[model samples]
Target: MASRVTMIAHLFGAMATILMLVWLLHYRGGIDLDSDSNSDRIFNVHPFLMFFGFIFIAGEAIMGYRTVAAERKVQKLFHMVMHLIAITLGIIGIYAVFKYHDEIGLSDMYSLHSWIGLGTFCLFGLQWLFGFFSFWLPKSSLATRETMKPWHIFGGRALLYMAICSALTGLMEKATIMGLKRGNESRLINFTGLFILLFGLAVDLSLSLAY
Candidate 1:
């Protein structure tokens, strides 16, 4: 069951990543969210896709932490401290998005979104590196392993949720500012999220059975 859950989470994470990569490409290619004016302040689909996309990241992080915890190779204190730091940074980032929301436009917010997304990406990237490389803790003691897990899990999960909220809020703000009803624009994002989630679960279940 645990292995199944882990695989499911990984698949969702990968699908979300693909969506994000495509969105970035479209944005770079001058594909405006609105078909008309590139500078139009209207709210569109990007926010929906970007924000909810964090779920995949969060799910994966949870699975990874559980794996480490089950191993009992590390101390909990270290993991707790890392989580505190990551949450602190994530909260600040979330606050920054709302605080500057009034002063920022949708197009401008996209820029902000990119930067914030990068922050989340960096945290997860670090987590992946540590997991695969096992460089986070030396082979010395259980205490050292415990210390590394907190930071790895907390930092990654916090950033993921932060990005999720930040993106969704930006969409709401944009819709309000432009007086445009674009709730439908978010449908694609919603569908993609569901699809990725289901697909992931299936993969995880299958993998668990095989194992």
Candidate 2:
């Protein structure tokens, strides 16, 4: 059951990435970090990286243990590596948005999307740190680790959903800002959001089944 669900999650992840790329490149005009329209180009990086790099990879990290047949330590290592990569990309995504804002001389963290995004990112970072220190390097006592396990799992799952919320609101906010009507672009954006939501749901389901 877990394996089947994991496969479904992978399919959703792939579909989400394809839809995001099509929307960004075909509908929104391809991204460029050093373009004349710095604000728009840089803003493009925000969604691409957040969805493809951060959320997708984070989902995989969460499923690493259940999906992979490996030693416990190996699974843990893969999980941490995936999350670290996601965090690195997430940092770049956040930077891209702030850079875009700077270029446009606009204040930051003024929207609901921004508020939830920033909160999720900070909490994710703290969760990653706690997981690393508590479970990996200089490992805690077995009793201590066991005590912290449930909170760690709950926190991770909560943050994953928080990220999906951020992505959905961000998509709507961008669509509104761009005045997207009932067209291919708008429809693509809607589908992308749907796939992202599905991807999150599938990952959570897989984890629950494994447990």
Q: Highest TM-score: which candidate?
A: 2
Model 1, poorest ten-residue lDDT window? Answer: 39-48
| RMSD for each of the candidates | 9.7, 1.1
- Give per-residue CA lDDT, model 2, range 13-114, as digits (tens): 999999999988886777776667545877889999999999999999999966668989899999999999999999999999998898989899999999
In Å, residue 191's CA in model 1 sits off its true spot by 3.6
Candidate 1 per-residue C-alpha lDDT over 1-211 given as tens digits, one digit per residue, 9 for 90 to 100: 7665666666665665566445434432322334344332222224323433334434433444445455443533333344444444444444443433433442333555456665665665566556544534355367766676567545544654555554544444544554644454344445444545464454344434433
Over the full model, what C-alpha lDDT does candidate 2 score relative to the true structure?
0.92
**lDDT by candidate, in order shown:** 0.47, 0.92
Models 1 onward score TM values of: 0.40, 0.96
Q: What C-alpha lDDT, on a 0 to 100 scale, does residue 15 get in candidate 1?
A: 65
